[model samples]
Target: MKPNKHSIDFGKEEQYLNSDKFVDQIICGDCYQVLKEMPDNFIDLVITSPPYFQQREYGGGGLGNEDNIDDYINNLATIFQQCVRVIKKTGTIVFNLGDKYLDGNLLLVPYRFAVEVQKRNPVKLINELTWIKINPTPKQNPKKLIPSTEPFFIFSKTDNYYFNKDAFLEYHDKCLNNGRKKVGNEIGKKYFELIDRSILSDEEKALARKELNETIVDVHQGKIESFRMKIRGLHALPYGGQAGGRLSQIKNKGFTIIKIYGNSMRKDIIESNVETIKGNIHPAVYPEFIVQELLKLLTKEDDIVLDPFLGSGTTAAVAQRLRRKYLGIEIHPEFVEHAKNRIRQNINNHTLDIFI
Candidate 1:
């Protein structure tokens, strides 16, 4: 799909506004107004970690108010409403959120956002994944337990969205040994013929010869050595007894060939390892890994990704790295500057270019 020219120009405008001589630069401004200037259905994904209500003092138009959680929900819903309008029909929205504490009670902030988002009726709830933090910060709470984990809420604009499942497959063809056996005998004979005719390189012949031996060994281990004589025509030596026995045992353990295709579906949400950031812009800043995953799963190349309340520009940086156009709104100038610098550094590293 072609990217919207307007959005591309807007990204260029950000680069020019910064006057940093860097392409695809981050803009320092409020995301809502910036997003309003952008055309609708331009973004492929909206993956963001917004500030939790009254969590910390972000200095400029930050998340505030302890008296009314309902008001917070309403404000969040308004931001998401704008997000829904700009996001493409095939796009996805992932909110990495958590709960808050109020009067010794755990406030269901993530759930509240979920309920409010559902009221829009245009988007569908995909999954509520639990981001299990392997090593969480220890805290002493006299009345209740310290919070350790957070919620990553996945939402989609339509039932049919962009998800490349095979992109995350763990196994590769190099991990497969069974299929190599069937072709070994034929390949070995061809190799010997080519070597005798001086039509193949020594390295090529050696690799083919080794494959032939491994195939014979595999057949013997599988107890299907009826064609051993055919394979023996290549005059290959028997594999080392101990090593062959170990290979047989390894094969017996069952070589699982996990074929990950483009249609692979993942229902589980991945977690990011907690790491410290340089600045204390906010108490909770999401890891770049989490944002990168969302961008890969939800958006397409050159598609716009919006982040209202972009705390530290984790979303923007990830989006830029993945070649997706991004709009990040931050009320705090310091955070905006931090996010802009982070993106500028990424651009200098050539990690934020769409063409790259």
Candidate 2:
């Protein structure tokens, strides 16, 4: 469909709107107006953190001018209506949002937006993950309590949407092993018992148990004849931590023990750290980790990804890095320049692997 020319004013900003320098370029214009021009089912994934209603100044305008909560929901739904039309049937939309506080009442903007998106679009509510900010700024409310964290709503257009369970699993693994330590005497007793209870002949048992006994001896051989060293080494080796050092001292030793008696487990998602363009063009710039994770999960190398509210071009940058095609729309000129510079820099730095 042709774009609604009435809503867009691509006068002097047309220079940055289209570019051949970056394989995935940034467009400078209103997102609602620009999205209408894109072809249908052209994008693979849509991940963005839209401006919160009436929260902060994004230079384009203020987000908190919705008049009321209902108006905010309606406006968000209108944007998603267009987003749903352009997104592929198998595409996934992950929206990072937070609640808004007004008149001392905390409005659940995240939940409200999720409900509105599901109501207006064909997306399915998949997960409501909490992004617990480790070092969140304390809320400055004298009368009430402090709020610290936010929510990320993960939605999909179909049941067969892309999800990298392995990446999430790796995150879970790190969290699980944060304060893990082995139970020294208890573990030793269990290990010895298992060795003694073997039904094999003496020679067979000796050979089979030799490896286990050697492993235990190696732990206590050079170190102080304590179980701490053994347990520390075991934990470190599995977690890819430092192998041998005085830093391996088991202070306040904790153990993340995993008992595996049945079948082997496999994770579905894979995760990696991705770098971002150096500049604060958008306030709520999503981490490249998120974009890379989404790309790995949702689409193939050649698939297309779309971001209607392409703040600082994180989605496009990640798409380029992962060798995927991307289309981004931004409503602000400053952000458009920021995104364009970011894309160009990534291309020059060999961060983006453009396919065509």
Candidate 3:
């Protein structure tokens, strides 16, 4: 069937989304039909987990349950082509795709989709994240490794995308001294041994010992704080002091630990327990933590977020809770009602104070 197109009235794509009709609304229609009507460069971020191949039959005659792998990839390419047009130049698209099996043979669906989508669209795959579900369903056969990880492929419309690196900060209480003896024990012994071995005057030896003691005290009491590791010419340890010299540099040389405010450096692996929401009949619902993490990285306040396969309304509810505008499209009427009810309960019970 040919997609029914609707007229877009606003002069520019940016102005088109300013109208109230599209924001914070869920449209019950086919994803292709709804996506074709949207103006170009209108959506700020796109986050969705499209149905896997031969996974589910959602009462909509579409690509998820296609037996042929080539047909499945082709159908997904068409949907993402529309997504590339709708997303802004500085926007990002995060797709969480899972693996499937055909006749007991494992099909690498996520990697194939990533490669095929890039061929059809101008988007580039920037980051590949692994969602390690702690409580995934156990397979009856114990021959293979337990299925615990899923892939999240992050794509950007342009070379420079809008990413908020500081939004997802993880606070950890790290000890000041690690993998070393306490102050005045191991360091003091090493300093005295150095002073005795060196061919220097007594005064010089005393001065060196005093400086080393002061440095150790300063570091042990948390007087200094280390940030990120600077990629220097040599393999140096992380040091928090403001001192500079050949000795100081040599002292801070082997594997050092640094403290960065944000956890962007370690975001490639996500560890979360699988979520089980009461009354949610959708078998493949994403946890709220996953959506929240993606939103923090990709969107800002009032930015428009779109979910083409709005299963159980996890994305919309999380987007609303984060103060961003959202638009959801679900093809099945039963899922449309399911998503609406879930969004309503989320707004009423969780985000009521924020909206008011």
Each model's C-alpha lDDT?
0.62, 0.61, 0.72
- Per TM-score, what order, best first? 3, 2, 1
**Where does model 3 exceed 4 Å of error?**
1-20, 169-264, 352-356
**Error in Å for residue 40 of model 2:** 2.3
Across 188-263, the per-residue lDDT of candidate 3 in tens digits comes to 4644575666555666556656665665665566444323222223334344565344335345431122343232
* Per-residue C-alpha lDDT of model 1 across residues 131-235, encoded as one tens digit per residue: 767667777777666677888887888888887654432122223334435534353465356445543455544654565466555554543332322122233
Tell me the alpha-carbon RMSD of every candidate: 13.7, 11.2, 8.1
User: Residue by residue across 141-235, what tens digits does model 2's lDDT show?
Assistant: 68876665566677877787767665443443444445335425444555445445644456544553554455455433422122332232233
Best by lDDT: 3
Model 2, C-alpha of 114: deviation from truth (Å): 1.0
For model 3 the TM-score comes to: 0.73
The best candidate in terms of TM-score: 3
lDDT of 3: 0.72
Better candidate number, 1 or 3, judged by lDDT: 3
